[model samples]
Target: MTTSAIKPLTVLFFFLAVSLRGTNGEPCGTSSIQVQTINTGETAAGGDSVFEVQVKNLCPCSVRNVRVDGGGFATTVGVDETMFRPVDGGVYLVNSGEPIPSMGAVSFRYAWDHFFQMTPRSLEVDGQC
Candidate 1:
């Protein structure tokens, strides 16, 4: 075949490969989520350091039932239970088990002596990517 014809064929193959990958019938995993904590340079009522926590969902699909290892999470300041609360076994639930839309995030604040080692424990894919 001519050089021009081969170039078009290569491009077609590339697009086909990418489309196939998206339809693999698999959902995003906990790895697609990220937990970030930042010191706000402020103190709470008890003189503990205040930290802002943001949990971001990086997956293209929506997710729900997101749980994290609270690790005995505590703070002098109050955090909304509907946003983030410990249920049991040191696991904290996010968004009251509601779906966190694709690329969406949940944020809250806490006051403690040090930053908590928050890590994602589990999540369920709510929709297709």
Candidate 2:
């Protein structure tokens, strides 16, 4: 084949190889949300304290349907009241309803009321099939 023809074929093969190697559609993995403090060790009768949780997308691909559960706390308060609620809480559902880019992260702050107790929080992030 002519040198010019060979060049195009080589370029095409290279492009395909690179694209295949790119990170995409990876499986969901567990990533810890850094909790500054798990518990304050103080309980009030009618007051609340703020807590912070970090959610990270550790997968090589984007993640979607991210849901965070307060774990043991949820069972105590029930599902309706267990969702994270803070006046200025950073934890929230991604409104875009799209994938969280790989390695991207978001922080959430929640107000734990007297009725709510601090517990290990778990995050469930769904990925595209």
Candidate 3:
């Protein structure tokens, strides 16, 4: 294609990409999900154990589907979103319910038959801001 023709197409693509991020050029929290695993002594070997999963959003924008894939079956003790489930092989995915603001953190606990092994996390937000 001609250079001039390509320029307009490139511009259009750029705009579309920005719009999906957020409004008013706020940008999107595309890759800003932090996961913190805390060990709590609530059980013995192969016994019931408790753990805390802390998820934080370190982006200037927002993110969704803040999933934490931890090994073993678990129960959500506390969290803003109710869209949490076990995917496979003891991995769990949780929806943040809403966008997580920059530096905002969401914490939840789980009780399982084994220790905690979390991988790949996401984020959510706080009160309206």
Better of 1 and 3 by TM-score: 1
Go through the candidates in order and give the clash count of each.
Answer: 0, 2, 2
Model 3, residue 36: what's the lDDT?
Answer: 72
Residue 93, model 2, lDDT? 42
The TM-score ranking, best first, is 1, 3, 2
Clash count (model 3, backbone only): 2
lDDT (tens digit, per residue) of candidate 1 on 1-129: 999999999999877765533344456667778999999999988899999999898877888999999877988889988889988889999988899998899989999999998999998889655
Task: Write down the TM-score of every candidate.
Answer: 0.79, 0.39, 0.50
Worst 10 residues of 3 by lDDT: 120-129
Q: Summarize candidate 2's per-residue lDDT along 21-110 as a digit string, tens digits.
A: 333422443342222334345433434554444455555566654544343332222122222342123333432334566667654444
lDDT of each: 0.86, 0.44, 0.60
lDDT of 3: 0.60
- Candidate with maximal lDDT: 1
